[model samples]
Target: MTLTKSTFTGLVLEYDSGIVPPPYSHVFRLALDWSKGDMIADLVLHYTEREDLSEEEILDEGFTLNDDYNYQGPLNSVWIKPLQQLYEKTRWTNKDIEEGGITVTPLEKGKDEGVKIPSDQEEWQLMAQDLIQAIYETVKKEAPLKVNYRSVQGDEIIDCSLTVHFSNREVIFEIAGKSRQINWEYAIQLMKIVFTPDYHYELAKEEAGKKRGAYIDCGDGFWHELGKGVVNIDPSFDAVSKIRKGFDELISE
Candidate 1:
């Protein structure tokens, strides 16, 4: 799968949430726009269980409970949105699967001459958008269940809704408005190698006495060129803690 900026943002958000889980039954969900990426982080409270308190009162109590945590901002920004209490939904996904779609004839690559690769930034951006669309279509058609994923990158990436596809054995993320798939296995493996329990994620080869991009830092920094190719193309240092947590949830599900 090709990793795009749009999808990258949600991965960031999810990673953030994992590093810090919600207070009890409370969960933080990021909002997404098809064109804008993520507009706000929504606070979903388990109101059904907290019947004794009013929403406003409950929120006030929570802030008093954890002063260090920030959600609502003084500036009233994208990082902060009004609190929303939502009830549990039923029948969003199906348990039983194995139903296939209509079989269609396959189309081979064009017989036309050699393709020209994009060398300019503008050309690459245009191509990235197209690639994102293609990945989205592939997942929508092939995967039985798809769900929305949000961002921890805050305003770093463009606003778009990202998605993940789940099967029995593994999971894949296409993400947001411009879809792109990445090598999920390779990404997880790389994350594991670089992740440290005490200090969290690192993008450096400490033994080498120098820092490097995560993609190349591992192997010859002893990184091998083998096995299904590269993952964590450019992971932000210290992000693996939360990102890996989110990854675990998806795989477990």
Candidate 2:
């Protein structure tokens, strides 16, 4: 069957009576507004059983609940099942609605170009810290060395120190006061940051040739290179060679 706003309204109404106690039965009203492509469902429970109650008393006794879901593709194909599940599983809480109580499908097919969800800074910081730690541990496994790395937390750049034990294959991170197993893959990924300028230049050149922007994930995070002014510059061979030599010396020790 074709899914429309009315279909959603009917589904919500079907589950409204289940939301409250029996005494509050038949007092729930469900409203759906779809004027803007986005669907909003508003559920209000009124004190309808007590006809003798004054309008003010009724207003005081009623409560409202709201949920929003985005719509873009065919409703029947994309949202009907999740909508039904959301209605069935919704519950009232002392605070705001519990997370995961509502599930909305993303508009993959209809998403507008150039529209992007902003990244969570805190989450990105945490990921960066983990990657740095993992890389430190991996290098420490190869040799006895003292490595210094920096991670960004909020507006602060925190410096970290690591002591690598080649015999036991353990890396002790002083900042976190913890030790983790070596992760070689993560170490290689972090090494890319040391050569980022080189890769960025190459990427910019490639994008200039293609006349489009290039998206790159050099194991750390996503980076974009737009084709605007592409300058042919040599990758930082000296810096990369120095880093390799230093690592080799550490392993020899």
Once fitted onto the true fold, the runs of candidate 1 whose alpha carbons sit more than 4 angstroms away are 1-25, 36-92, 95-188, 193-253
CA deviation > 4 Å runs, candidate 2:
1-143, 152-155, 188-253
Name every residue pair that clashes in candidate 2: none
Worst 10 residues of 2 by lDDT: 67-76
Candidate 2's residue-wise lDDT over 1-253, tens digit each?
3233334332322112334432343433333333344444444434334455455654565532211122222121222333344434443233322221121222222331221121232332233233223333334422344545333335554334445442233445445454444443334333443343344543332221222222322323323232222222345444444433433333333
Cα deviation at 77, candidate 1, in Å, is 16
TM-score of each: 0.19, 0.19
lDDT of the structure predicted as candidate 2: 0.34
RMSD, one per candidate, in order = 21.1, 24.4
How do the residues 1-253 of candidate 1 rate in per-residue lDDT, one tens digit apiece?
A: 3323322222111111122223333322222222233332222222123445555765765533332222321112222121110001111122321221111111112122222222232332322222223333333533333322222233332122123222211334443334445454444443444433222124333332212211122322322111112234445644444443444443333
Q: What is the C-alpha lDDT of each candidate?
A: 0.28, 0.34
TM-score of 1: 0.19
